[model samples]
Target chain A: MTAENQSFQPKLSDSPLVVGNHRLSSRLIVGTGRYDTMEQMRASLEQSGSDCVTVAVRRERLYDRNGQNILDFIDLDRYTLLPNTAGCYNAKDAIRAAKLGREILRTLGNPGADWVKLEVLGDSRTLLPDPTETVVACEELVAEGFGVLCYTSDCPVTAQRLKAVGAASVMPAGSPIGSGQGLLNPNNLRIILEYLKEDDPEYPVIVDAGVGTASDVSAAFELGADGVLLNTAIAHARDPIRMSRAMQYAAMAGRDAFLAGRIPRRLYGAASSPSEGVISSRPYGTLGKGDQGNSQSGEG
Target chain B: MVEITVNGQAVNLPRPMTLEEVLKRVDVPPNYLAVEVNAEVIPREEHSSHSIGNGDELEVVTLVGGG
Candidate 1:
């Protein structure tokens, strides 16, 4: 549709979405990592206005010195838990973690837990997604009846491949994971969103990483992203709560602007002057003296 | 031989020793402050494994109760 001619309609509903029976009210998903304390994390989560938060699942049960379980603080009823395979390096390891996540959720009585933030990295330095292994893991997880959320490269082709492999949602990283670079390739993200929409209008595309500021989140939404997956942006912020609120507003503003159909950027500036006018150059102070440019208060 | 100082104790080890080797040799508690190697924070899961070479300055910064 042409930018000006197309009708503006909010495609997303105000209601919640049932992902494998877990209803999420907000599209934004926050992470519970890197926070200095539980109070800070809670405040940030509240400010981001997320309906869900992610947690990493390890093989063994762990407890702090106070014998407090890490999972104890998360109020599952208020927010849906998205267990991620953050440390997994390959398809097998990610899938293993996914299974463990499912089991934990099931034990907690969340049987229809199918959503996972799949991360299979090639190295620790860049934390770049290995497309080959990521696709493999996604295909397997989808086959296992899980709604796979593939955290993948920003490359449009890579995103398309993930969608083809039965990914419920394609989460393309804005930059390197956790670098907080903030929209390194906005043009590429825009292209990815356009490509995905053209292929399957119903497919959800979320901007998942390297978002450092509220403006970065807004840029993602302006490109017509379905939602955002944020962690470091809030966790590492100097004032996480304030940053969270800004992020929330940024997401909403960006979504609204996208729905408003932003005007295309023009290469050349266009003049909007009268076709025929006697353009005259007057001295700066004398221009307002005559009838042509007289002010309402003309005593002087 | 490489000179490595961990938790204020100087020790001798071969060059190119992995962090796992150093942790195994040191008497610092596993629950000590987060490990910082040359000012870069390394997650605990990586401490058991991940290699490092000589001239690498590693510091374990733990979180303490302080308002």
Candidate 2:
């Protein structure tokens, strides 16, 4: 029987997204950046319904009149903090950033913050991930006992290599960071997904960048990606709160549609109604109630 | 007087002190800050005993906003 005719429930939807040792119900991971205000960030996060949020580590304010820290605005119980090595340009710097992130999280009484989103950019022009450095850093971070979520290009070989090198999750970008290109090469992404899932169906593959709108996020889910990591798409939207809500529903709908199994395409049309059940009709020359003129005359 | 760098900024103190005392003098909240002395991470429990000498480089990092 076709999937549409089946009545089985989609177990994948009920299963939580497992990254490293942590299980999250919401697959959408949002970033705490580019928002106009901390309130907006908090509200958008709530609207997105994401359980994990990524934060960067930097020097603390020695003295501040505003008396504001990102941690103060975020509710620790609601979101799992995932620190990222965003500004690091090489493996050494990325490792240092990850270590600093771990220390910061530990100081905050969150010892489970060992999960680091390792991003080592090649250069400032393209902002593409340096695959070689990323692998090196991933291996070292994994050996150091950090749950390494290595961000890489949408190349199947690189994704496979990162996974083989002890990366808990493989995150490939749809395009350059913050470019809003929206899955520039979907076929490549599909290949990566297929290659990774070939060995382990439950291997976590997250699309980490180049998401432009709600549909972009939905498309990622429909392509069988495990999750999406986005910042500019929502944070830079004209109405961030509404966009966040849209993304939440879009991700869920896409996952459901993928699990339900889409119908195959065909070259010819197939009638939905019974072709033999039509009432008896006269020749084409005969006119009906609404057909004042010969319908066949249009063929002339 | 002894000088050491905190977050890349040179700071002078009358004498060498522990990581805990430097953090206090710099107004960094002990609970929200992490101390790395000379590129080595000092655990939270050892911050009190990790002594800071002259010309020591310390990197004090805290959680910030990111994507």
Candidate 3:
């Protein structure tokens, strides 16, 4: 739908999404990767209206002539920079990455620099998280005073373990990383949500990774997800800028729909119009003279 | 000469130097870089005192695009 024709204003919950004591109004988090240029990344981020963006810690471009850095393009004042350990494969490496991110943030004087998006992949093929290593890293990072956002599979047990280990937010992947499969096992996600909410109703459960399009994001929010972290869905879209806007609106729509309860389904079709209106002149069981005697007659 | 790896690239320095001096030699802005010596993070406050020796492995990381 065109922007001019769209009139639905989502009635989002007044309650803010809280993660590690930081309250956020926007539920959609975008990433800075996979875009063709930094300009596209910036535009998409602006269009998405995301309050948070993830960045990886890599080697500095010490010898580049252009002297352009990703940080230079991003507005630190507008977005909360969530540094991630995307390349790290083990707990030790992930911990070091997190520490390095904190150091960089400390130098920049960002208040939320201590927060890290901890991801430790098990292998290179699937790019799935290693649950054992993830738990170990979460414990250490929490002890080191870092607000850890743990990424894991859509397993309720693993999510509970991460939360128990002091992860500020439990991010369960909808599917494999960068696969764009989009909520492959929604029933498992539902169970995770139910289990977490049973323990604490306000616990933040963000669906991270494997969101292909706007509908995937909306579905996650409809499943009672607190937030969504996506990169390829917007960055790799045919038109990243437009896709970003679509994702933003979809997130709002999904959250509002979840809040507004839906109706139950039945075997028989139910009429929405008033049944008391009597437009026919014939009696309940009596047929008019013009009507055929057969029940299959075409008379109304 | 002291040989060390910086971001997985081997580099030879004339002599042992502090992390701060190494950063200046490499032309990296200290405020935007995080230094890790031998896989351990060296806080900004310790850059002046932290020394790089022979065969030391240093990883200087800056923020980059990621999901």
Candidate 4:
């Protein structure tokens, strides 16, 4: 007799998301902000099962000796710190922030020093990316030898432009940052994927921000997205740890579902069983909702 | 004492000192921090060798929580 079936491997987002020189098997990049406590943030990070986390560079307080640093809570050995220019509203400030972030990460001897998440906001109110400033920053960062992962609104043209400007990965926002709206326009995301991955299928396109729930992540993956980067949804949830776990599973499920492939939608019903068998005379009563006009047959 | 600008505030320093000595004024540990003097970043290894003169603007930054 053969050995008891023990060769099964659990399904997850195992296919690595290769962005620039960084490769993450988890495929979910989380942020280290908006948590009520550092302890909660640490626990959520553990539960999130993400290998990459983003942080911002800010002036280190001089006199306040409370002894609380984000690095103290994070395990630098386990997590790749992707420094972000989150609050910078212009290209010059954004570039300066990126350099500072990279220097800190480099001093820590982490590999993530090579890449930066470039976010140049147009305004503080909407928190949207300034297309002009963003492009300028991407070009400058790339020239400076930093792998730039740009965050922009869900605009296909901007996505293409970022790629054209040598961004390591183009991360388009699903909606406004922290609004919890979730992938507001998946069609735009699809078109972005098509544009960026046209000939270069392996080029990574990560959907960043405004992920309200786990379903939004699954929907993005099902729509052919390579990865998703979200912060507020998990950090600000009622139970952040559990919500982070849900997000991890959602990413895995979505990626697996995409790899497993989905069925094509048809306006007409297609029977699984043979039509000639005529099971129970087709049950011809008032058809169920959405089954109204799908009973018809023929196709070329 | 000579005055120097740090993180947008004017502070009095005992005298001209190395960038490393300038960073010692902060209460936070300098483990993962970067220093900038007059808009030029001073590499961590050179902090002890580079000098911070009077009126030099400095910025000491570290990692913070952000999305």
Q: Which candidate leads the pack in DockQ?
A: 4
lDDT of 3 at B2: 97
Task: Give the alpha carbon lDDT tens digit for every residue of A1-300 in model 1.
Answer: 888667677566444433444556676888888777777777788888888888776522244455444455666677677767787799987886676566556545443356787888888899988899999999999998888888988999999899889888889999987898988888888888888889577568888989989998988888878888898888888998899889989988887787788866755433344323537654564533223422234223
Winner of 1 and 3 under lDDT: 3
Highest TM-score, which number?
Answer: 4
Stretches > 4 Å off in candidate 4? A1-13, A60-66, A272-279, A283-300
Q: At residue A47, what lDDT does model 1 achieve?
A: 87
Give per-residue CA lDDT, model 2, range A229-254, as digits (tens).
99988999999999999999988987
Better of 3 and 4 by lDDT: 4
Q: Could you give the interface RMSD of each candidate, to one decimal? A: 12.1, 1.7, 1.4, 1.4
lDDT of 4 by residue, A159-211 (tens): 89999999999999999999899989989999999999999999999999989
- Give the local distance difference test score of model 2: 0.85
TM-score of each: 0.69, 0.89, 0.89, 0.90
DockQ-based class of model 2: medium
For candidate 3, lDDT tens digit of each residue in A93-199? 99999999989989988766979999999989888999999999999999999999988999999999999999999999999988999999999999989988896
| Stronger candidate by DockQ (3 vs 4) | 4
Model 2 residue A127 lDDT score: 91
Off by over 4 Å in 1: A1-23, A266-300, B1-67
